[model samples]
Target: MLLTLAKEIGFSHAAAVDPSSLKAQQEVRELCAADRCGHYGRNWSCPPYAGELTAAQKQLARCTEGVLVQTTGNLADEFDIEGIGRLMQLHSRRFATLARQARLLYPKVLPLSAGPCTVCRHCTCPTRPCRFPQKRLSSMEAFGLMVGDVCRAAGLPYSDGSKTMTFTSCILIMQ
Candidate 1:
C-alpha cells in the first residue's frame, strides 16, 4: 500500500531505512546549532526549538524501520529558490498525509520531513507548544542524518543534476 502511494505521488525513489543507521544525537545537535540550513532557529521543527537532538534520537531509536521517499520536480534554473520551496512544501504536505495513513497500519510511525514542519502557515509551535505534535515530523538533517549516505544505502539517487527541484521525506515505523 505504501509503495503504491509513493508511486502515485510521483516519488522516483522509495525504500525503508534501518533505524540503526541513524547518526549520533550529539553530532546532530552540532549541525543544527551550526545553522547551515538557515532554518535552525527560524522554524518550529528546527533546532533551538525542536528540543535536544539526543532526546529526538532516543525517541527515534524506538523505531525499527523507516521509509525514505523522494519526489523530483523540474525548475528553470538554480535561482528558483521560491519555486523549490513551494515544491518542497507541496511534497511535504503529501508526505505527511500519507504518513498519517501509514500510522493506521503501523501504530508507531514517525515522519521525518524533507524540511521543517509546516503544519501551519504561521507556526505557533515553540511559543506555546506544538499545535499538532502527532502530525509533525522533523527533517532528516535534524537527526544528523547524512541524507546522501542514507539515500545511497537505500539504493536511491540523492541527485540527478537536472538543474531542477527535488524533495525527499521519510517516516520511521516501529515494528
Candidate 2:
C-alpha cells in the first residue's frame, strides 16, 4: 500500500530499511552543531531542539522498517533558490498529507519529513510545544543520514544537475 502510494505521488524511488541501519545520535548532534540549517539549534525539529540523533534512532527502532522516498522538480538554474524553496515547500505539504493517509492505512506509521517540521507557517517550535505533535516530523539530514547516500542506497539518483531540485522524505512503518 505504501509503495503504491509512493508511486502515485511521483516518487522516483522507494525502499525499506531497518531503522537500526541509521546513523548514531551523537553523529547527528555533531552535524547539527555545525549549524548547517541555521535552524539547527533554533527550530524545535533541528539540533538542540530535536534532541539527540540517538533518540531519533531509538524511536525508529520500534519501527520494523523505514520507507525512503524522493521527489524531483526541474529548475532553470542554480540561482533559482526561491524556485527550489517553493518546490520543496509544495512537496513537503504533499508528503505530510500522504503521510497522514498512510497512518490511517497503517496506524503505527511515523513520518520524518525531508526538512525541519513545517506544520506551521511560522513555527513556534522553540518557544512553544509543537502545534501539531502528531503531524510534526524531522528531516533525514537532521538524523545525520547523508541524504544522497541514502538516496543512492534506495536506487534513486540524488543529483540530476543544477537544473533539478530533489527532495527526499521518509516514514517509519512499525507494523
Candidate 3:
C-alpha cells in the first residue's frame, strides 16, 4: 500500500526494507562531521543537532520495517548541477508530502531524507528552536545510514549502471 502511494506520489523507486538491516555506521556520521555539504551544525536536522547516530539507529531498529524510496533522474551528464538540484528539490517535496501522509497511518512514522531539511531557507539552530518541529527532516547520513547499504539491504538497486543520478530516502513505520 505504501509502495503504491509512493509511486503515485512520483518516486522513481520504492521497496520494503527491514529496519534491522539499516545499520548506522560511524564512518557515515564522520562524513557529515567533515561538513563537505556545509550543512553540519547549521540546522536542527543536520549532524550534531540531529542527535547521536546510535539513538537514530536504535529508534529505527525498533521499527518493524520501512519503505525505501528514491528519485532517479537523467542528468545531461554528471556535471548537470542544475538538473541535479531540480531533481533533489523534487525529491524533497515528494518526501515531505509522503511523510505527512505516512503519519496518518503511523503517527510515529520517522522520515529520513537524502539530504538536510530544506523546509526553511535558513534554519535557526544552536539558538532558537525549530520553527517547524513537526515538519523537520533528518537526513539518512545524519542518522549514519549509508544510502547504498540501505538499498542493498532492501533488495533494491542503488544504481542501474546508467549515467543517472538517484537520491534515496525512507520512512520507517513503527507499527
The residue-by-residue lDDT of candidate 2 on 16-100, one tens digit each, is 6556665644655677688867776567777777766667667666777677877778887888988898888777877887798
Q: Please identify model 3 stretches exceeding 4 Å from their true place.
A: none
For each candidate in turn, the TM-score is 0.86, 0.87, 0.94
Between candidates 1 and 2, the lDDT winner: 1
- Winner of 1 and 3 under lDDT: 3
Tens-digit lDDT track for model 3 on 17-60?
88878788889989999999988888899988888777987888
lDDT of each: 0.76, 0.74, 0.87
Candidate 3 lDDT score at position 116: 89
In TM-score terms, which candidate is top? 3
> What ordering of candidates by TM-score runs from best to worst?
3, 2, 1
Ranking by lDDT: 3, 1, 2
